[model samples]
Target chain A: MAIDRSHIGVVSEPREIDVEKGQLRFFAKATGEINPVYFDEEAARAAGHPTIPAPPTFLFSLQLGAPAKRGDIFDPENGIGVDVRRILHGEQRFTYHRPIYAGDRMTLTTTTTDIYDKKGGALEFITQKTQGVNAAGQLCVEMQVVTVVRNG
Target chain B: MVSPVQYVDTAALAVGDRLPDHAMGPLNRGTLALFAGASNDHVPLHIDSDFAKAAGMPDVFGHGMLSMAYLAQMITHWVPQERLRTWNVRFMAITPLYATVICRGEVTEIFTDNGERLARLSIGSWIDDATQTLGGEAIIALD
Candidate 1:
């Protein structure tokens, strides 16, 4: 089964989160990222940032605070009518307009941009984009996530 | 053992210079679980082996972000975190658990664009098999 093309352009509710130093530190450690700017506020300031700037790719973790709940795509009862087992991550892209600092509250808005298939419906790819804005009303990052579904 | 990002002087290096390669793992289940908790991506493909097998996948596989983290490690280990402008990755293959993956990158070009000097790099990771599990390019603003 192909992804419901009609689901394209659907926007999810925005999720708000407060960036925490300890949380970022834990992520940084788990990724084996040792940049002091991610764990030390003073070091970040020394580098001209107001607070600890999350390391690149750290925003991925923050987005989980508002992942798509069942039914949006996987809920058979009400969702886009696709099997969860057929999906795979196809691509991920991130663009940072500015560094996200510790203590910065952010709002993430996720939207599905496109849904297309390849090889006569054997493979389908869904393109989704999420924009993150800081409390100061500045754009922090834009992440594009792609989900590929295999239809047998 | 978190270390500081060391800024680099672009003039000091040549276009052919290879950035330091970060060789990581024998990645195990424990590390994969820790990454799942840390990244908040509890996707069953990376955490639930039975679920993955049910989905026709070979047990549970590592998250693509985990390999990206390895790429980030290669970058931050060599260049200061602040100097990095953009890094994007394409998931080429599944990096299975317990496989040692080596992240490698080489400076391809350094040029001036719109008053900003940037270095372009061809980055990839090798996972035991001859083929790379992940590959992509990156642009970093120079100091």
Candidate 2:
């Protein structure tokens, strides 16, 4: 089944999330990060950070905390209609405007940027761009993800 | 325990210089489960063999984000996390279970952008069997 091209440019409702120190530590440990700045607040301060700065790529996980709105483009039924099993993460990109600290609150919004197919419709791709802005209204990060769905 | 960190001198860096390789794994179910919980990505395809088999994979595989995280760790080891301007990756292949991954990066270009020196690096992660599972690029501000 072909994805709905009309979904392009659709934006999700903004979601707010608090960055927490414990969660950052957990993520650091999970990824085998040994950097003290990611684990110890004192070390982070010593390293010239205001607080425990989020490790690189940590924003990707933080964005996932937002609840998926039903009938969104990722939905298997009413949205793109591709089965969940068929979807694969194809590409991911992150452009950081500023460092995100653990004490910050970020507002995240995702927009469907593009939709297309390849391999004669055997592979469908959905591109979505997500931005995280701090409470002060400064953009902290921009992430673009490409999702590939296989059709048989 | 806080470990000793050696920050890279980006000003002294030259193009074609390779960052130290960061290696992790022989990834197991525990790592996948821990990552799934920590990252809030609970997709069963990473943790459930049955689900992966049903999805046409022989077994559960590592998440691309997990590999990307490792790559991020590698980049930060060379420079500060705050120095990262951009990072990107493309999933080239599925990383099989128990495959140890080595993340490597090479500085491809160095130049000044708006008075801040920056280094653009070509980065990728290779499995123990030498399969390049992910390819990516990163740009970092040099102090």
Candidate 3:
């Protein structure tokens, strides 16, 4: 089945998240980041950050905390109805306006930006754009994700 | 010991300069499990061999985000994290289990935009056998 093209331009409700120091440390370790600013508060402070700054790409994890929109293309019942097994990550992009500290609170919103297919419909791609805004109402990051579904 | 924060020397930088290579893993199940927990990406395709087989894959594989994180580490290792203005990657192939991935990048262009010096880079991650698994571009603010 084709993805619901009508779902394009749908915006998700704002989802809020607290950027925790522990999560930042864990992510830094898991990714083998040797940068002390990502783990040590004193080092981060010395480096001129308010606290442990989030590792690059850490926001991608936080973006997942957003509440799933109804009729999401990934949904099996109300949307594309494709098997989760067939889905693969296709692309990811992040544009950062400023470094996000662990103590910050962020409000994230996602929009379905595009839906298309390739290889004669054997593959389908769904693209979503997400923005993270700090409590100060400043835009902190913009993330774009593309998910590919193998129609085979 | 704390590593001092550092930035790429913009004045001496030139197009075709290479960023230091960053390598991680002969990625095993433990790494996958840890990444799954940390990244909150608990997809069965990445951590469950049976589920992966059912999905037509030979075995469980690493998450694309995991590779992306490693690529980010590569960038931050060369320059301070705050210098990153934009990062992007396209998943070109499935990173197989136990593959040691090396992330690499080259400065393709350098210019000033809006008074901030910036560099554009061609970046990718490859397996030991030289298969490119992820490819993309990144733009970083330079001093």
Candidate 4:
């Protein structure tokens, strides 16, 4: 089956998350980041951040904490109908308007922007847009994520 | 595990300048599992060898976001994390397990807008020193 084009423009409910220092530290360490600002409070303050500022890809991790248990669009019930076994990440992009710090509470909203296929529908591409907003309702990051599913 | 934090000076950059490349791992299962746990992306294809083999893949693979994180590490090391104005990448091929990949970028363009000096970086990840697994661009601002 081809991807569900009717699902295009579908938007998910807002997912609210509180940025945690320990989580940030874990992410930093896992990704091999040795920046003090991610581990030391005083260093982060000295660097002019309120607390530990998340590493760039940290927000991508936070996005996974979306209220929905299944964050991937191709999950069985997301209505897109792509099998998890065939999906491959296609493209990932982020436009940062400002830094996000630990101890910040933010909301994330994801929307399906477009869906199409190529190679006689053997590969389907789904493009989604996700926005992160700080507690003050400021736009912090705009993430453009694409997933490609192979149908054979 | 951590390199010294060195901010990239726009004054030090010009069109076609090559930024320092970040050599990432001979990625193994342990590293992949740790990343999956930390990132909360425990997709079976990344952590389950059996699932991957069932899917016709040789074994578990690394997450694309993990590759993206490597590129981001390169960017953050060069500038303050907050100065990253834009980032983008395309996952062209699967970066298989235990394969070493280097994340790299070059200064492709430099310009100023609204008093912000910005640099455009052409970026990619290369596997086994030959195959380009991912490709994209990023923009950073130096005020």
Q: Give me the candidate number with maximum DockQ.
A: 2
Q: Candidate 2 lDDT (Cα, whole model)?
A: 0.87
- Per-residue lDDT over A23-120 for candidate 2, one digit per residue giving the tens place of the 0 to 100 score: 99899889888888998899898889988988777777877777445325556543555677988999999999898899899998888889999999
Instruction: State each candidate's clash count.
Output: 1, 0, 0, 0
Can you list the residue pairs that collide in candidate 4?
A: none
Please identify model 2 stretches exceeding 4 Å from their true place. Answer: A70-73, A76-81, B1-3
User: Best by lDDT, which number?
Assistant: 2
TM-score to native of every candidate shown: 0.90, 0.96, 0.95, 0.94
lDDT of 2 by residue, B1-143 (tens): 45566878887999999999999998999999999988988889999999999989999999999999999889888888888998899999999999999999999999889998899999999999899999989999888
Tell me the deviation in Å of residue B134 in model 2: 0.8
Model 1 residue A133 distance off true place after TM-score fit, in angstroms: 0.5
Residue A78 accuracy (lDDT) in model 4: 52
lDDT of each: 0.79, 0.87, 0.86, 0.84
TM-score of chain A of 1: 0.87
Q: What is the two-chain DockQ of model 1?
A: 0.62
Give TM-score values for chain A, per-prediction: 0.87, 0.93, 0.92, 0.92
The residue pairs in collision within model 3 are none
- Error (Å) of candidate 3 at residue B143 is 2.1
DockQ of each: 0.62, 0.83, 0.77, 0.77
lDDT of 4 by residue, A73-96 (tens): 756675465678988889998988
| Fnat scores for every prediction | 0.65, 0.86, 0.83, 0.86
CAPRI classification of candidate 1:
medium
**Per-residue error at A119 for model 1, in Å?**
1.4
